[model samples]
Target chain A: MSTEELQAWLRRFAELVHEHKDELTALDSAIGDADHGANLDRGMTAVLAALEEAPPADAAALLKKTGATLVSKVGGASGPLYGTLFLRMAGADTFPAALRAGYEGVLARGKAEPGDKTMVDALGPACDALDAGRSVAEAAQAAAEGRDATVPLVARKGRASYLGERSAGHADPGATSTALLLQAAAETLS
Target chain B: MTVGIVVVSHSRALADAAVELARQMLPGRELVVEVAAGTEDGGLGTDAMAVSAAIEAADGGEGTVVLMDLGSAVLSAETALEFLPDDVRERTTLSAAPLVEGLVGAVVVAAGGATREQVAAEAGRGLAPKEAQLR
Candidate 1:
């Protein structure tokens, strides 16, 4: 992705996050600490301000700045996990490759697998779809499906794991946000 | 060299209070310590960047042992290690001990000029007393 596309994708993500903040927080309240929405919204707003204050020269620079901003500003689990994702995406050769690397970064940082009912649920399928030569729009659709699939999963990782069986009914908040990320990517980076 | 202790917690009040309680274990001696807790605005969260800063501040050129409350605090501490200098990162240890009790034990041990491993080991032993009493 070019610098402009990366910037657009993050901006779109911030917008989607703002639009769905309550829904995300509501989902989190069902099984998490109820701060995912607020934390991410705060972080993204900082990212926007940082980007405006110092526009990055390239895709790598943009991703690095975004990652660093999130790590410093989010102040939650999402901060390091999502921050690592963007940081790992900096040097990849293609959008799909960058996303795949980001998925791996999340995996390494969060240590959550597909069925663990985290962002990996949505991001994993989206990465697979993109790797299989699917359109960015199709990958976004796959991410939405993955997010929907989380409604029945018993979270085995993250703070939701504390609820054990009770965590099954709610769609994973991380998955929901991951779907929004892919959707934003489809809109801007594609 | 005295091992330094840095507490990473979701609440600034909690970390500050816990450190207050822990430091009571060492009366006159110096216990190199730092707190990397809460958001910049004092919300309930953990900032990796702040954590990175705390680790640097806590390091007395000997070593640092980071104790986290749980969850994201641990993740933040781990992420902070990535930003440290190679020498500091190699000497730093992330203790998997319970926050409050562990801080108490760690502070005492670190005040005695313990090694990094010994400080971490003392922190891990924080629950032993409670466990023993319960048993």
Candidate 2:
């Protein structure tokens, strides 16, 4: 996607996060520190403001700035995790490449594999769909499915992991947020 | 200038308190101790940019050693390193120790003109006293 389209995607993601802030926080309360929604909302708001203050010259610069803003504002595990995704994705030239790079970045930062009941659970499937030449819409659906799949698996990463078997039955909050992000991309980028 | 120390935590008050406690541990000794904690709004969280700035500010020509409170605090500290200049990054280290204990140990050692490596070692051993006392 072009820089303009990417910026649109980011704005859409922020809107979605703001709209679902309470829901996201509720989900986090089940398995995390219950601040994901407020944290992401604050970060996204700052990102939008930053974008307006000093517009990025290119897609890479845009993503890099977004990453830095999130890292500085989000103030939790999600900060570094999501920050790394966009920062690494800035290096890619294609949508699929960007998704792959983003996923790899999360892995490096979080050290969580697929089925860990973390964001990787959703991000992994979305990247897979994108790699298979599926449309962004399809990738977004895959991400949602991946998030749903987390409900049955015990968490092995993040705070949810501390719950052990009790982590099962609750949807992974990070995975749910990942789906929101990919779905935003599908709606805006496409 | 001796080696510097940075304390990272999810709470600003906790970081500040830890620094205060460490300073008390080394009264009359002047050592560079920086704090990077909480979100911009002073809520519970960790900020990598703040951590990076704290590390830079803490640096007194000697290298800096960082001690973090929890999981994400560690991650933020690592991310902070990426924002540091290459020369500063090369000298910085993240100590694998508990926060309060480690900072007190690190500050005491650094106040004595210890090297970064030596400060880090003392911080890593900070938990040993408690462990021994429990035994």
Candidate 3:
């Protein structure tokens, strides 16, 4: 895929977030703070508005703009964490390398471990699969499996952590989202 | 060639919602946007490993960009970097823009075929103030 294609994919993803804002919030209500949907929706809405006014010239510039926007608009942990990912990716030169670097930035900022019932569980395995020469489809499948694997784990972070062992047996909304991301990638690649 | 995007966040619901919103806005755009969200699973908040994997998979020959939603998600993504090859690492870009502005910037750039630098710069622009206020 070309850099341009990658950018389009990101735009589509933002739109999807806007479309299902309500549903996502509802999911969060099950085991986390209800603001998940609302927060992301608001953030994406702002993103769309910015894009409408002026588009960037390159992938790095585009992502940099996005990072700045998120830092200013989004609150809580999500803002800085997400913002950092874009900032790092923008610094990168190519899509694959940028992704690899971006993931590293996420790990440095978020401080989460694998099997923690976090998106990391799915993401870590997926990266590993890709490294192993697996196709994007295969990697995505692994991500899905990783997401489902969270069902039996307990919550160790965020509001869900408050539930402690009670968090177990519940599918993590974040992991599920990660699975969707992989699916989207697969679709685009195909 | 089509491309894919990944939106990362602390909450899975938030990530899902972001994806849904993207779908609604650009129904005609030939791109795919995915979500990589962290859950309150017992181990940690967000899963860097999962996020890294998603990014790797999203990578078409052109590569992919990752947008994250705070805390451990970022940390996990960073950790996952070790697993990526140098070539893939070279293509990736990460930023710290506001979530909404960043998402929009990325989409617009992607749709328009802008470069990574351009997208990052736009994201830096953040949300504009109300027009009326400017006057």
Candidate 4:
């Protein structure tokens, strides 16, 4: 993707994060610290501000800056997890490959699996779809489906895991946000 | 003769208080303790970039040990290692120790001229006293 397209993806994801901020927080309140929405929103806002301050020269620069901004400004598990995603993406040659690398990074960083009722649930499917030569829109759809699938899984990672069976009925806030990210990529990069 | 320490907590006040408590363990000794806590906006969270800066600041060339408050704090501290210089990063350790208790033990051990591993081990066992009390 071109730098402009990547920038658009960031803007789209930031806007989505803003719109869904309360919803994300509500979900987190069910099984977590109830700050995911506010945290990601703050991080995205800073990301946009950073981008505006210095427009990046390439996709790598844009992704690196975005990742670093999130790592610094997000200030939560999401910060390192999402930051690793974009940072790993910065070195990959293709968007699909980047997604794969980013997914692996999350898996490594979080030590979470697809059935862990974490972002991996959504991100893993999206990566699989994209790696199989699916369109970005299709990958986004896969992510949404993966997110929906989280409602039935017991928590196995993250703060949510503390609740065990009590966490089964709640949708994962991280998966919800990851789906939004894939959707933004589909919207802007595809 | 000291292993630097970094306290990563979600609350700035919490980190400051913990540092104070830890520092108190050594009345007149030199203990390198740094805190990377809360967001820049004064919110409750852990900033990896801040943790990275703290790691560098806490390092005394002996090594640095990180003690974190919660899950995010641990993740942020781990991520912070990526931002450190190669040699400095090589010696840094992220201790899976409870915040308050661990910091106190780490500070005490560090002040006594222990290595980073020893300090971390002391921190790891900080929970022993409490657990023994409960038992």
> Local error of candidate 1 at A139, Å?
0.9
Q: What is the DockQ for all candidates, taken in turn?
A: 0.80, 0.77, 0.05, 0.82
CA lDDT of A181 in candidate 4? 98
What root-mean-square deviation over C-alphas does model 2 reach? 1.0
Deviation from native of the Cα of residue B83 in model 3, angstroms? 28
Q: What are the chain A TM-scores for all the models, listed individually? A: 0.98, 0.98, 0.85, 0.98
Q: Indicate the worst ten consecutive residues by lDDT in candidate 3 chain A.
A: A71-80
- lDDT for each residue of candidate 3 in B1-135, tens digit (9 for 90 to 100): 334466777677777776666555565776656665654342124544456667777667555567776654555556446547787767666657666656766676666666656656665564554334677
Q: Which residue window of length 10 is worst by lDDT in model 2 chain A?
A: A155-164
Q: Is candidate 1 or candidate 2 better by TM-score?
A: 1
TM-score of 3: 0.55
- Model 3 Cα lDDT, one tens digit per residue, A1-190: 4546655666665766667667666766777776555666665566656766788777777787676565434443454556666777787665455656766776766667887777677777777777677777887899889988998998787667888888787677666656665665666653
* Candidate 4 interface CA RMSD, Å: 0.7
Clashing pairs in 2: none
State the lDDT of candidate 4 residue by residue for A1-190, as single tens digits.
7898889999999999999999999999998889999999999999999999999888999999998999999977999999999999999878999999999988888989778888999999999999899999999999999999999889888789899899989889999999999999999996
Model 3 ranges off by over 4 Å: A1-3, B1-135
DockQ of 2: 0.77
Q: Candidate 2's residue-wise lDDT over A136-179, tens digit each?
A: 99999999999999999998987777878988888888898899
Candidate 1 C-alpha lDDT tens digits along A1-190? 7788888999999999999999999999999999999999999999999999998988899998999899889988999999999999997979999999989998998888889999999999999999999999999999999999999999998799999999999999999999999999999976
